[model samples]
Target: MSENNKIAKELVEAVGGKENIASVAHCATRLRIMVVDKDKIDQPKVESVDKVKGAFYNSGQYQVIFGTGTVNRIYEEVTKLGLESSTKDELKKEAGKSGNWFQRAIRTFGDVFVPIIPALVATGLFMGVRGLVMQEQILGLFGLSPADISDNFLLFTEILTDTAFIFLPALVAWSTFRVFGGNPIIGLVLGLMLVSPALPNAWAVAGGDVTPIMFMGFIPVVGYQGSVLPAFIAGIVGAKLEKWIRKRVPEALDLILTPFLTLLIMSTLALFVIGPIFHSLEEVILNVTVSVLSWPLGLSGLLIGALNQVIVVTGVHHVFNLLEIQLLERFGNNPYNAIITCSVAAQGGAALAVGLKTKSKKLKALALPSSFSAFLGITEPAIFGVNLRYMKPFIMGLIGGGAGGFLASIFGLKASGMAITVIPGTLLFLNGQILLYILVNLVAIAVAFVLTWMFGYSDKQLEQTNEA
Candidate 1:
């Protein structure tokens, strides 16, 4: 058999053979398996399987980390063994059945926001580039100042940097509707209506440059340009309304009448009710978040950075998606991204130290790649495969993260983006904050590495692991 085939067979045996697997699927980095009985699997043996970086039980599924590209190959091999193949969406539904109401709600929010991140990341990169090229110092070298640049060129840059955020509500609404099982096209239309050109621009109204149109002589109505909660709630309500109308309408008129009624009712409710109420609620949430992050003496950064990896272990870290989105929407910069990068970078550092110090070749092999993965902002392999397996290293990483976060807050470092972090996150800092970003991440890594090297790893621990 080929190497992936061999690993696939070993993995199947490790998880209690083919009979115990109810279904199998793969995401970007994991081979997710829904099992007949969680108790039947040998956790250690699964981790020991060659080419498997780590394994964890999460959301009622056994997720084996194989990194990108590798998981697809192994997944194909696993399916060849007669196990039922499944989609990631199907696995999500099965896993959703096990979580509590809060977990389910958070997962739903994650589902709604995750698909919209790539557009934001691209926009952030464009913003960073625009900032770089428009710098007074850089423009001076080229015999140009801000006024020397062409208006058309400036307009083009604005288009690149501003379009995604200007239409953010539409993206959120579209994703939310898709997640809630409505017609995505209808969702797109409804979302477009939220930011229609006919309405006064939200940013302009906020700046007192324009007045909002009054719906009933008292209720002010403006476009939702960078809004999140309002659009998200509208999507949920609109999707449900569409589904309900579809069931009641006659089969002959279902296509035309259902959409017409759904859009009409949802549009009125969204503008007069959901939009106004949720927008206020979103502002309150933004205020609370800002207050927490602005705590005296960098306490907020220290706590969040130290605890972020711990939260990741609980499988609920997706909740940060909303906070980061809100921060980017309201402030146009995200300090939370800078703080979390420290926590993530520290994981890699601890894993690197363990990899270098470990006497066991098996562990050294696992730790090195896992550490590299952590530096690139995906920490699961480092956290589960290396650092957490050696408990002291994980704690050392937390300390390192806290130290870096404290400094980040003191420096007032922030990113122009969200979703991406650690090394690749440099793009978000290119707008004049790159130096501080580098310094903070280096501090985090150095502290974790030095601490872990001194006290966290030894051959004795390997012996204990083998014995267990």
Candidate 2:
């Protein structure tokens, strides 16, 4: 048998065969298996499977790590074992049932925001480049004055930096629709309509550059340019409404009427009702978050940094995308990303320490790549596969992250983008503060490494004991 098939067979047996698996799915790096009987799992055996870095049960799924490309192969192999397989969405639905109300809500928030991150990340990198080129020192290197730079080139940069936020509502709505089992295209259309050119631009209205047209005499209605909550809430309402409409409409007419009524109804509700109310709520939320983030002595920074990994483990870290967006919209830049980058670096540092300290060949192989992955701002491999497995390393990482975050806040480190961190995140600070960004990351890595080496991990003594 092939290596994939070999491992797949072992994994299935370790999880109590195909009968115990209610549903199986893979996400990025882990095979998320929902099992009928948790006790039936042979956890150690699962961990020992070839190419399997680690295994854990979280929320409601038995997650087996196979790292990036390997997980997909193992997933395909597992499906061939006559077990029921599920899409990411279907797995999310099943897993959602196991968590408490708060946990479920956080997961839902992650579901909505995670899909929109790539757009934000791309925009952020463009913003970083834009910031760099606009710098006097950077322009001096090219012997070009700010006025000497072509207006057309500057205009293109503006488009790159501005387009994502300008159409953020549509992105949010589309993802929300997918999460809620609605027609994504229809959801996208409704979202686009919420920010139609016919309405006053939201940013212009906010800046008092354009007056919002009065609706029903008193309600000031404008396009939801950078608004998130309204589009997300509208998506849920539109999706549920569309699903309800789909059931009642005749099949022949369903194709035509369902989309029409759904769009028409959702557009009306979003603009006349949901948009105005949620915009106000968004403002309030932004204010609260800003207040907390601005807390004295870097209190908020330390708290968020220390617990960020824990949040990521629960799969709700994507909500930070919303917070980052809000911060950038209100303050023209986000310091939170700077803080988050430090936390991310600490995980890599801790994993590196563990990798160097471990005596087991399997553990060393797993730790090295996972650490590198963490440094590149995808920390799952390090977190689930290594650090979290050794509880002390995780805590040491948090302590290091908190210290780094506090320093970042103290120095007022900020970024031009929401996504991308650690190594790639250097671009966001390249305009003038790259050194500070580098320093914070170095501090995080150093602290986590030293602390983890001291107290976070051991050199296979426990493994030898278990074997004996």
Best by lDDT: 1
Q: Candidate 1 regions off by >4 Å?
A: none
Model 2 bad stretches (over 4 Å)? 464-468
Per-candidate TM-scores read 0.97, 0.93
**Candidate 2 structure quality by residue, lDDT tens digits, 1-468:** 888999999999999988899989999889999999999999878877889877888767888888889999999998988888899778888888887888888888888887788888788788788888888988899998798989899888888888888888999899899889899999898889988999999888888999999989998889998889999999999999999999999999999999999998999899989999999999998998888889999887798788888888877776677788988766668899999898999999999999898877788898898899989998877887788877789899999899889889888888988788999999888778899999989999999999999988897644753511
Best by TM-score: 1
lDDT for position 104 in model 2: 84
